[model samples]
Target: MHPLAKYAIGFVVLCFLLFLLAPFAIVPSGMRGVVTTFGKVDPVPLGEGIHLIMPLANRVVRIDVRVQKAETEGDAASRDLQQVVTKIALNYHLDPAHVSTVYQRIGEDVENRLIDPAVSEVFKSVTARYTAEELITKREEVREQISRALVARLTPYGILVDQFSITNFRFSAAFNQAIEAKVTAEQNKLKAERDLQRIQVEAEQKIASAKAEAESLRLQKQEVTAELLKLRAVENQRLAIEKWDGRLPTVSGGATPLISINPQQ
Candidate 1:
C-alpha cells in the first residue's frame, strides 16, 4: 500500500473505535440503556455503567422509567345541560414489567393516544352523573370516582395511574348568573322569615304587659268601691237628724227619735 493510503486506513480504524466507545462512556444516573441487537431488545436493562455493543447495526435506547405527570384539560356537559371546563392532573409511571408491551402498542409518547383519551373519557363519563353545582360542591367525590375509573381503564394499557386531582372547574356565564341569583333569593327569604319571627315575639310581649296593667286597675277599682259605701251610709244619717221638725213625743224615759227628715226646718 502507498504511504498516504496506509495513514488514511489507520485514521478510519481509529474513528470507528471512538464511535463504539463513546456511547458507552457516560451512562447518567436514573437512566437505563436498552440494548437492541438486529432490531431486537435484550431482556436485561443496562445500568449506570459503561457498555459495549457492535459499532454498526446495534444501538442503545435510553428509557427513563421514573414517575411522570400527565396534565390534561377538557370540557364536558353536566347533567343539567351546562358546559363545564375541567382540569385534570394525573400522576403516572411506566410499568417496568410491561415495557415491551408499552413499546409495541403506543411507544414512549403513549400519553397522547392512550392516557389523554382515557382521561377525557373518564371525565366525560363521570361528569354526566352530576350537575354542575354538585361537581363544584362535592369535588372530592368526583375526583375519587374519576381516579378509580382512570386507573382501571389505563392499567391494561401498561400505564399505572398513581393519583389524580381535579384542579379547576368552570361553568358557562348564563348558568353561573342563574345560580347566583337563586342563592341570593334563598338567603333573602330566610332573612325575611327571621325578621317576621322577631316581630311576632315582640308583639306577644306587649300583649302580656297590657293584660297585667288592666288586671291591676280592676283590683284598685274594687277597693275604692268598699270605702265609698261606708261614707254614703253615714251621710244619710246626718241628713235625717238635721231635717227633723221641732215637735217631740215622749215615752217613759226616752224621747221619740226622728225617723223622717224634713229639709224645710
Candidate 2:
C-alpha cells in the first residue's frame, strides 16, 4: 500500500476511537439524570452538568425536578349530596435527591399517574366534609384543606406540593337558579324595609305637624280676651247679615230680638 493510503486509514481509526470514547452526558439545569447500568438502576442520581459513564453499558434518563403546574377538572359530591364540578391548579415539584427512586417507582409521568389522581381524591375527601353552599362561600378554607391533605399524602412519595388553588366551582342549574332567587328575595326584602321606614318617618312628621297646629290654636285661644270675643261675634253677625236673603224673620217663641253695635263706633 502507498504511504498516503496508510495515513488515511490511520486517521479513520483515530476518528472511530474518539467516537467510541464519547460517553459524557450533559444533564440540563433543573433536571436530574438517572443512570442505569444494563438493567440495574444506580441509587445515586447524577446532578446537572456533564457526567461520564460507560458508553455502551450505562444509560441516562433525565427527569425534570423543577416546579410544574397542572390544571385539573373533576366532579365530586358535597356533604348535602350536591354534585359540584371543580377546576384546580396545582404547583408541585419532584424531590431532586430522590430522582432515581422516583423514576424507578413512579416513572416520569408523575403528574398524570400520581398527582392528578391525588388531587381528585383530596378534593373529593375535603369536599365531602362541607356542604355545596359552604364550598362555594368558603372557597379559601376548602382550598387550604385540600392543599394540606395533598401535601401530607404526596410528601412521602418524593413529590412536594407547593400550592393549590380552586379556579372554578360549578353547581347544578337548579341550585344556581335557587341562589339567584334567594338573592333577589333578599334585595326585595331590604327594599321593603327601607320603604316601611320611609312611611314611618312620614307618619311621624304628620303627627308632629298636627300636634304643632293644635298647639298654635291653643296658644291663640289663650291670647283671646272677652272684648276680643265680643268683637269677633259682631264681625260674624255682620258677615251673616251680608249673606242673608231679603226675607222677614220668623219667630216661634216669645224671645226678644237684640241688635248689635260695632265697637269702633
Candidate 3:
C-alpha cells in the first residue's frame, strides 16, 4: 500500500473508534450521567449533550432525571383486624440535584428498597388508625394521611412523592354479604314505615271528615225547633196529598178534607 493511503486508512479507523466512544461522552435529552472513573464516583453530575471523559478509564451511569411512576400492590390489615388486599400506586420522580446521594444511599433499586417500605409502612400506619367501615366511608381522609406520611419519609431519599392512590380493597366475603343484607333490611323497614305513615295519615283525614259531618248535623238539629218540625211535617203532608194516585175517599158524616183549596181557584 502507498504511505499516504496507509495514513489515510489509519485516520479513518481513528475517526470510527472516536465515533463508537462518543456515547460515553454524550447523554440524551432530559438525562443526567454520573462519571465513575475506574469505579470512583464523581460528585459533579454530567449534563445533557457531548461530554469529555477518559475513553477506557471512565464510564457514565445514565439516569432519567424526570418524573416517573411506581405502582405497587399488596395486602394490608385493617383496624378491624380484617385482611384486605390493596393496590397502592404512587407518582414519583428522582431529584436531579440529589442524584449522587440517591445513587449512593438507595441506589438504582430505590423503588424496591426505599419507596416500597415507606409505602407499606405508611399504608399500615394510617390504616391501623381507621376501622374497616371507616376505611370504606372515610377513605379520602385515610388516603391523605398516608400520602403525607409517604411524602415525608421518601423526600429524604431523593424520591419526591407526588401523589398516591389506594386503588382497590377487598373485604371478607362474609362481611360483604352481611352488609348487603343489612342494607336490604333497612330499605324494607323504611318502606314499611312509609306505608304505615300513609295509612295513619288517611285514617286521621277520615276521622276529621266524620267529625265535621257530625258537627254540621248538630247545627242543623239546633236550627230545627218544635214549630219548624211541625211546619216541615205539614209541608210534607201537603206534597203527599198532592201526589196521591188513588181514588178519592168518600166522607162519612162531617169529615174535614185533607187539603183545602181557595174558592177563587
Candidate 4:
C-alpha cells in the first residue's frame, strides 16, 4: 500500500521482463544461429536477424557461415624419399543448411578440428605419390588433387571447400645443392657437344679447301710441261736445217764433222 513499495515492485517486474526477453537473439549477417532445446539441437537453423525462443530453456549458438581462410604448414616425404616442407592455404565455409548438424557434431572449431587436419593429411598423402621434382614441376596438378581430396573429405562434415592452394614447397639444402650441380653438369655437357660439332665442321671445310688447291696446282703443272716440250722440238728442227750443207765435205778429226771447202772456187 506504500508508494515506495509499489515502485519497488514495479522495478522488480521490469527486471524480470527484461530477463525473460533475453532469450531473443539477433543472428548477424553472414551467420546462422543454431537452437538447442534442453541440450538437443533443433533440425532447423535460425537465419540472420532477431529470433525468439523459450527463455531459460533454449540456447542459440551463432556460427559464421561466410567464407574463411586457413593456412597450414607441415613436412612430408616425396615418392623418392626426399623430405618436403609444404605450406598450404584454403578457403571454406560452413553449409548454412547444416549449421546445426555441424555445431552438434564438430562444434565451432572447424578450422582446427577438420580443415587443418584434412589439409595436412591430404597433402602428405598426395606428396607421397609424387617425386620432389614432380611436386615442383606439376604444382597445378598437386593443387587440384589437394582441392579434390579436401572437398571429398570435408563435405560430409558440412564444410564446403571453396578453394585450395599449395603456397610453398621446399626441399633440404643438400638436395637443392645436388639439383643445381646436376643442372650445371648438363649445361656443360651440351656446350661441349656443340663445340665438338663446330670443330668437326671446320676441319671438314679445311680438308675440302686443301683438296681444291692441290687439284688447281696439278692442272697448272701439266699445262707448263706440254708447252715446254713443244718449244724444244721446234728449236731442234731449226738447228738441223742450218747445219746441213749443199755439198759433202771431207771428214776431219776422227769424228763425223762436215767441212766446207769454200765452194771449191
Candidate 5:
C-alpha cells in the first residue's frame, strides 16, 4: 500500500461518517423542534434555527407554532330538547414553550385528537344549557360560553387558543317557519294598534272643531236683545230718509182734486 492511497481512503471514510450522522438539525421558521433520544422526548423544546444534537442518538421533530384554523360540525340537543346543528371554527397553536410536553403526550396529530374533541365536547355541554329559542336570541352568549370552556380544557395540554367562532347554527324547518310567522303576526298587531291610535286622534280633532263652531253660534245668539232690534229698525229708517227727495202730492177728495201750495217766501 502507498502512503497517498492510505490518506485518500481516510478522507473518504471521514466524509462517509459525516454523511451518516447529522452534525446539527435545522428548525425552520414558525416551528419548534422536539428533541428525542432513543424514542424518548427530551424535556426542553428547540427554538427555530440550527441546534447541536447527538449525531446518531438524537432525533428532532418539527412542530408548527403558527396560528391554525380547525373547523368542525356536530349536532347537540338544546335545553328544550330541540336538535341543533352547530359548525364551529377554532384558531389555535401549540405552545412554543411546551412543544416537547405536547409531543410527548399527544404527538403530532393534536388537532384531530385533542382540539376537535375539545370543541365538540365544550359546544355540546354549553349548548345543552340554552333553550332553542335562547340559542338563536342569545347566540353571542352561547359562543362565549363554548370558547371559554375550550380555553380551559386545552390550556393544560399546552395548546394555546387564539380565537373561536361559531360559523353556523341550524334549526328544524318547522321551527324556522314558526318564527317567521310569529314575527309577521306581531308586525300586523303593531300596525293595527297604530291605525287605531291615528283614528282616535282624528275623531278628537273633529269633535273639538264641532264644539268650537257651536260655541261661536251660541255667543252670537246671546247678543241679540230687544235693544239691538230697535237699534236696527231706527238705522234702516234713517237710511230710507236720506235717499228720499222732499215733495208733497195732491189728493182727490169727493172726485175733486185738492192742491195746497205756498208761494215762495
Candidate 6:
C-alpha cells in the first residue's frame, strides 16, 4: 500500500473510535441527569460523572439536587376579612432518586410552577383560618401549618421541602394605626393605675402620721393633772433658788421685783 493510503485508513479508524466512546453527558456533583430517548423520557436517571449513549438519538438534561431557595410575596385575606400581604421564603430541592420523574413532569422551572403556587395556596388557606391578629401573634403556628401543607402537597411530585419561613406581614395603614393606639392606651392605663396606687399610699401615710400625733398628745394631756402642775411649779421654784446669785434684785420704777425675795437665807 502507498504510505498516504495507510495513514488515511488509520485516521478513519481513530475517528470512528473517538465518536463511539464520546461521553454524551457529564452530570456534575449535586446534580442528576435525566435521559431521554427520541423525545420519550426514561424513569431511570444518570448520576454524577461521564456517561456514554447513542449519539444523536439520546439526550441528557441535568436537574439540580441541591437545596434551592424560592421567595415570593402575595396578598391574602384573614378570617376577619382584613387584607394581609405576606412574603415567604422556601428551601427545597428535587428528590435525588426521583429527579427523572420530577423533570418529566415539572421540568427545570420548579420555582415558578411548583414552589410559588404551592406557597400561595397554602398561605392563603392558612391565613383564612386565623384572624389578622392571630396571624401576627401565632406566627410560628402559621409557619408550621404552611410548611407541613407544602410538604404534603409537594412530596408526591418528587419535590422535597427543607425549610420554610414567613419573611413579612403587612397590614392596612388604618389597622396599623389602630394597633398602635391600642398599645398606647394600655400603657397609659397602666401608668394611671400606678399613680393612683402611689396617691393612695401617700394618703395612708398622712393618716397614720396624724393618728400617731393625736395619740401622743392624748397621752401628754392625761399625764398633766392638777397635782402634777403644783409639783412642777414647786420644782421650778427650787431650781431658781439654787441658780440665784448672792444678791437681791433692785426695784424697777418703784414696782416690785418679778421674783420676790425677802432675803437670801
lDDT of 5 by residue, 167-257 (tens): 8889999888988999999999999999999999999999999999999999999999999999999999999889877654445674555
**Clashing residue pairs, candidate 4?**
none
Candidate 5 stretches with Cα past 4 Å from truth are 1-12, 233-265
Quick one: best TM-score, which candidate?
6
TM-score of each: 0.70, 0.79, 0.83, 0.73, 0.85, 0.86
| C-alpha RMSD in Å of predicted model 5 compared with the true structure | 4.6
1-265: candidate 4 lDDT, tens digit per residue: 9999999999999999978768588899999999998899998999999987888788999999999999999689999999999778898999999999999999989999888888899989999999999998899998899889989999999999888877789999999999999899999999999999999999999999999999999998888876798898899989987998865666667776655567768
lDDT of 3: 0.84
Q: Tens-digit lDDT track for model 1 on 178-234? A: 999999999999999999999999999999999999999999887787669889888
For candidate 4, what is the TM-score? Answer: 0.73
- What TM-score number comes out for model 2? 0.79
Each model's backbone clash number: 0, 0, 0, 0, 0, 0
Q: What is the C-alpha lDDT profile of model 3 across 1-265, one tens digit per residue?
A: 9999999999999999987776447778877887887888787778888888888888888888877788877567887887767889999888887777788676778788988878887888888888777888998998899898988888887788777898977788987887799889999999999999999999999999999999999999999899999999999999998998866777789775787668998
C-alpha RMSD of each candidate structure in angstroms: 10.3, 6.3, 3.4, 9.1, 4.6, 3.2
Off by over 4 Å in 6: 1-9, 16-23, 225-231, 251-265
For model 6, how does the per-residue alpha-carbon lDDT over 1-265 read when each residue is reduced to its tens digit? 9999999999999899877756467999999989999989989999999988777788899889999999989689999999999789989988999988998898889899888998898889989999989999999998899999999999999999999999889999999998999999999999999999999999999999999999999999999999999999999999999999967788667976475657864
Worst 10 residues of 2 by lDDT: 253-262
For TM-score, candidate 3 versus 6, the one ahead is 6
Candidate 6 weakest lDDT stretch, 10 residues:
256-265
Each model's lDDT: 0.82, 0.91, 0.84, 0.91, 0.91, 0.91
Better of 5 and 6 by TM-score: 6
Q: State which candidate, 1 or 3, has the greater lDDT.
A: 3
Please write out the lDDT profile of model 2 over residues 1-265, one tens digit for every residue: 9999999999999889868776779999999999999968898999989999888888999999999998889789999988999889999999999988888998889989898899899999999999988998898899889989999999989999888888799999998998899999999999999999999999999999999999999999998999999999999999999998956578888675766768998
When 2 and 6 are scored with TM-score, the better candidate is 6
Pairs of residues clashing in candidate 3? none
- C-alpha lDDT of residue 205 in model 1: 94
